[model samples]
Target: MASCTNWAAHKLVHAWLLAALLVTLLTLSPSLSAPACGVLATVEHPVEAGRPLRLLVVGDWGRKGRYNQSRVAQQMGKVAEAMNNIDFVVSTGDNFLDDGLASVDDRAFHESFVDVYTAESLRKQWYLVLGNHDYRGDVLAQIDPALRSIDSRFFCMRSFVVKAGTVDFFFVDTTPFQLKYWTDPGEDHYDWREVAPREAYIEHLLETRRYNYLDTLGIRLNSGSATELTWKVAVGHHTMRSVSAHGDTQELLQLLLPVLKDNGVDLYINGHDHCLEHISSRDSPIQYLTSGAGSKAWRGIFQPNEDKLEFFYDGQGFMSLEVDAGLAHAVFYDIDGQALHNRSLSKSNRQHVDQAPSLVSQE
Candidate 1:
């Protein structure tokens, strides 16, 4: 039985296939992997000071509303405008509410993302990570197109090293491993409470290897970026240490921090705690930030021995990070452009030695 729609689809598909075959036959050559679009804008400290590489980091903001998401976007755009430009944007996760908007294709993407992020300069550099909400919602297809359309180079659950002048950033996908949830056969979302009717487990399937941050991406982490590079940062969608109703994320921290510390990662940016807190690790200068204020204006509650916190704020805003070699500066602002928090990190051992002989001294 050949249905009219099926016949029509078949003819269309056949025509496309014929064209592909013809092209292939005419061009008998090997194919190459898609070129890796360099992750967000990367550069080193020695870059021209006249033009600083600017970036805004925000997360958990897919829900479109007034108190937070809307206000935050407005303020972020204002800052980007003042600077005359922006390099890229990083999202820690929770791109949407409840269940990641049914799918990445949901109308919410336009309202929450497209409308809010109308800054033309920002379109090219948006790095996104899947939050728990995205996982719960069946948005695999929708998510891909939205992100790709936004920034084809935008990555999810993958690692891409970006060189900001002289620093390297290794971004990871921590949400998938945090916990696996399943939805019923026809459900668009997984119930946080009830497990899916059918549950199956696949062991050692690569991405599931939580510690792979040190294994697969290990090379990137241990690249001796030490002194050659001014700074190295690790970004994810979950928190390492936070004090809020959402509380501390011990499971993720325990598994991830050691790798970061050992790899000379100076800063950790994440979104999930729904607040902002820049904490200094007692054992290390590595900075931990919580900027889950995309839609959630949740407050922060300092933890025990939390004095290392240089700045903490609960506002609807995003963080603008500037890194120059070993020195990095961060400012979190409110909807009115008022600075809510500011923090900076400089390498105590700041020196530039020519590791590559093929270099010329600017001086």
Candidate 2:
């Protein structure tokens, strides 16, 4: 009888200890508990004068809070907090999932964007562009100000320019450049309701008159001369160069590369390959960066373009950038908030030599 009583007491003590541990863990910061939102990672860097722009770039993240989306958001929150003064977030399209939001009031909007990225640091303005997936749904709703009424952080347009300090960011609408979307949508349903009859849109984009001679001036030159344009960055949803399964975008290369080259653009940031990558061209000053690993990732889909490819990772993550007057610093972090790659470039290092460039080569 005494042995039975002692065993019962021991079991009770064990249960109490287990419960205490659980409570302690739950009480800690959400990030410390596990991969979750609302947790802030502590990072401190002294702000240098003349290099005031700081931004976070993410893409293809809308998965309705699943597929590591929440975890990635959590890490972004932490990074944002640590790296203070993040001016804004660049959404490289595919902001919505599979088919995109059905309407301005679509449930997916809240489920994927609002509820998923509920971190204090993520409250900044979100400059967004449409992805090919976004075309599969109501594309107008995304660019409408109605979304801003829902959450003031949302900002979307077909193409526009934003000037922050000495730098000029050119946001380009790239989904229309793909000929396949026009010729063969296949099993996918693309809601071309707003800008249907693909040929017209492409013609207008390519036409110097309809495009306001913008194409002739070159998108990069729009930023002005070196004295005025310290940094020129081009952001788009499609990639002109990549080594992933999607490979290189032929349309973008033909239409966009010349403009980038002519204008002496510093970096071309895109998110279509669904991974993180950096490709440095020996022939041009422009560096290619891919930050499509917002949530879903293509495991082992790398094709390894060894000539220009610098860094490539097939996983879920995002990229952070800090631009100063003389230097541009880039870092890629995984879902766990771990830094994967870091590279910096001096303003004097900007190359503009003309040569037929190869795509991202494998390491």
Top-TM-score candidate index: 2
Report lDDT per candidate. 0.58, 0.72
lDDT of 1 by residue, 1-363 (tens): 444345334323222111212222222212211211111222222344556566788888887654567778877777776655667788888876767666555777677777777766566457676676765666353334345554353444333455555556666656544553342224445423211122111132233442223443555555454465557778877877776546556656666677787777788888877777777788776788877877767464545444366666665677778766555667777667676666555665532222221111111
Q: Which stretches of candidate 1 lie over 4 Å from their true place?
A: 1-50, 142-147, 150-159, 179-213, 224-227, 299-307, 350-363
By summed lDDT, the worst window of 10 consecutive residues in model 1 runs over 32-41
- The clash count for each model shown is 11, 12
lDDT score of model 2?
0.72
User: Who wins the lDDT comparison?
Assistant: 2
Would you estimate the TM-scores of all the predictions? 0.72, 0.79
lDDT, candidate 2, 112-229, per-residue tens? 8989888898898788878999888887677666777788778776665565655667777788778898788899887665355555445545662323223523523552334643
